[model samples]
Target: MIWEKLKEWMGGGEDGNGEFQPEWITLLEKNLPLYKRLPDEMRQHLHERIARFVESVRFEGCNGLDVTDDMILTVAAQACLLVIHRDGVPYPGLRTVYLYPSTFSSIHKSVDAMGVVTEGRVHRLGESWETGTIILSWDSVEQGARDIRDGSNVTFHEFAHQLDHEDGPTDGAPGLASRAAYRSWARVFSESYADFQELTERGRKTVMDAYGATSPAEFFAVATETFFEKPRQLSGKQPELYEELVGYYGLDPREWLP
Candidate 1:
């Protein structure tokens, strides 16, 4: 009811659904032209959805982090682009975004075999929860916007987890449009993940980051960062996985960048 009221107050008059508007598109055009490097149609498609997502999520700056409106919109735009060409499925459960000045520590919660709760601090640049809250660091976000080749992006990584959670848990599986797509996705990801793990174990060099060897979930998120950031490298090294991601995201970074 509050969101509905806020939606109406925000001049989202049509159906009071808080949908994106032409004004937001104009604002995005004026503020986020960097994304214009993408094809015109693709840019337009992403603009509206990105604006809507930015509007829907609440952002807070912590530890004196200067959370500029443009910075938030830019980060949200890039993250939302990964899902723009797909069907409409609202980001399940994510509403608040807490931004920090830099990498922060989070208390990790775990249960032992005896049902004892263990708590430990884990330093991170970004994190996403199934309950709809995503936390990110401003420094990490700024770095990501500047360097697209490092295969490290707080926005992409956290949002990839958001996508993965749509299917339930963030086990590297997102909701696919069809069963056939799921089968293909599973095969390529399984093989690539395995190969990356073996490479890491053998202390071999990899184009992608070794962080992917952390877990299947981390593998998916890290691979997503590489998929968008270093599309040429990912495609050259793991063509099948690249194709699967292209199919899922519906946009080819190679075409955009090249």
Candidate 2:
């Protein structure tokens, strides 16, 4: 059954143009604000990607939550947006997604300069692991879907980590076309990240979230959220960084704007 679903998703439906169920379309139109803004061709492509993801990946309900088909589609659609214009299988390294009812607490460990480790429980909305696993708060997912222009989406943020980990460990850089692309990406992201960190330190408003200042890997994720949600603003303020993302993703989100 799963194989058949995968075939249908990849091969396109009876219409031969990447069709989705009418109910699914309605749900997406209501919950995902960006869905309405996408060009017809892109929306079709996204439908195929979401279907492929829903069939291939395992989704589990955590902490007494029950994973529903609607929930899976909602989350998968947002995740598929990242790879909608890229080639190859979607998220080849990913296998499972665990959904929670709301914010959850987990143990967090940190080491000091003295080499002493301290551990405590911290509340989290989502997590992406290199071990083919992701955990998310369903409420947060819904919140992200409802507001597409906020430049903040836990689904996009975590999936960005998944993309960053595809080549190896989670670095600020994902797999680029060539050494030159890699070099350019490194130089641009390094400089942009440093500037982002300084701006964050001064507590100034930024197009990107301050949480991105946490690390290079995190900067990439945050920038991804900004790129998709606030493409025009990001392009205006950070043209170089926006150009790099456009080169990598193979899509210019500014086209989605009116």
Candidate 3:
């Protein structure tokens, strides 16, 4: 009953049926222009997905930031875009989203060929952990939502990592439908990742960002960003990669764009 009351309060309707609010639609249109570009049916589906995500995921404000309904809906709508067309629960492994006011510091460990381990503190826009926790910077998230075409979204990047981790570890691969699907994913991703890295090293222009060259996991995450944000450029530049993502995500983002 508490969740029902919360939903009624957030939806601005006393019915407590968890329907999408008109003000929420206005917020999405103003904050995330991409939401306005989606097809009518997909927009309806996204509303349901956003409601489910907001209900299921625990969102906590970090530092002194007070999480508001506007912030929650904006982030939820964008996060749900990744699984808008998929069946079943979204981000099954995800339990918590910790939001910071801006970029936050985190300690990372790396190992060299000599088996030497080193730790360093680094600033990060977002981070997805295997333990079912995702930390994000609200400022970066808002910027990503507003820009929509840059192929650089903190929510998409971090949520893509969550997808990658669902199968096991955060490898380049997520859970595939069949053995053949896995084979195709591995082949295309491995070869494309190699080529992408070489192109980055040569300082050539690439549809995927240079940061994707860091690792297979990061490459997949970056590719997800490009897939949704810059569908035209990504499809034109890397047809195979685009097709693979289209098949996996079960949606043609090009159809959503003019």
Candidate 4:
């Protein structure tokens, strides 16, 4: 079989054997540092989830760059990390992931609280919409992959928004198991967001990024980056926020930290 056809077969699914292609596994292990450090048990789950995500999400190269197996696998690996411990759909609404060779600009329309309409072109490293489409820059994704300690994986960050959107669009609250879960989530996240904004306003250097102060949804995504990348510091500095993420994700990053 030709290489591309082989990749397609292995990535999409194995007829009788549900396993990833050897080359795809090799590329994932070689390129993703976070994936490499996962416990053997977690790695097995990650591999399965990644293969499923790769098969599910339609990958499109937006510009001239041709999407490679490595590229698709890399992005899929990070995305599936969000649901590693939880028994839930990876991305129930997400259908396509658009890749840009570099940072790209798009025209966005917004309606203000006062019912004013505005449209503007904005440049972004990554962006996600409720429509199950995501746009991301390859450069950002590559950098985020290379530096495992940094809390800025575009793929991870963007997919997190999808999780957050599972509940609704107004806030970053995600779908939870029960009413009590929602209450607890709100109590913890609201307090943490307020504290984060207060710290940012006072010019205090927090482990969390100031960008999180933008909104609850942004906070959830930014906090996700920190949860996965700077788990140690995040757990140390923002203990409540840390626990919330650990609970929501069903895994503790502190355990994976070096």
Per-residue CA lDDT of model 1 for 93-142, tens digit only, reads 67888999889998999988999999999999999999888899887887
Q: For model 4, how does the per-residue alpha-carbon lDDT over 1-30 read when each residue is reduced to its tens digit?
A: 223444565545556554556777688778
The Cα local distance difference test for each model comes to: 0.78, 0.88, 0.88, 0.83
For residues 100-211, what per-residue lDDT tens digits would candidate 2 score against the true structure? 9999899999999999999999999999999999999999999998998899999999999999998997988898879999999999999999998999999889999999
Model 3 off-target regions past 4 Å? 1-18
Root-mean-square deviation (CA) per prediction? 4.5, 2.1, 2.7, 2.9
* Error in Å for residue 251 of model 4: 0.5
lDDT of 2: 0.88
lDDT of 3 by residue, 52-160 (tens): 6777788899999988877888888888998897755677778999999999999999999999999999999999999999999999999999998888998999999
TM-score of 4: 0.90
Give residue 208's lDDT in candidate 4 (0 to 100). Answer: 75
> Candidate 1 overall Cα lDDT vs. reference?
0.78
How big is the positional error of residue 156 in model 3, measured in Å on the Cα after superposition? 0.6
Backbone clash numbers for all candidates listed: 2, 0, 0, 0
Model 3 clashes, total count: 0
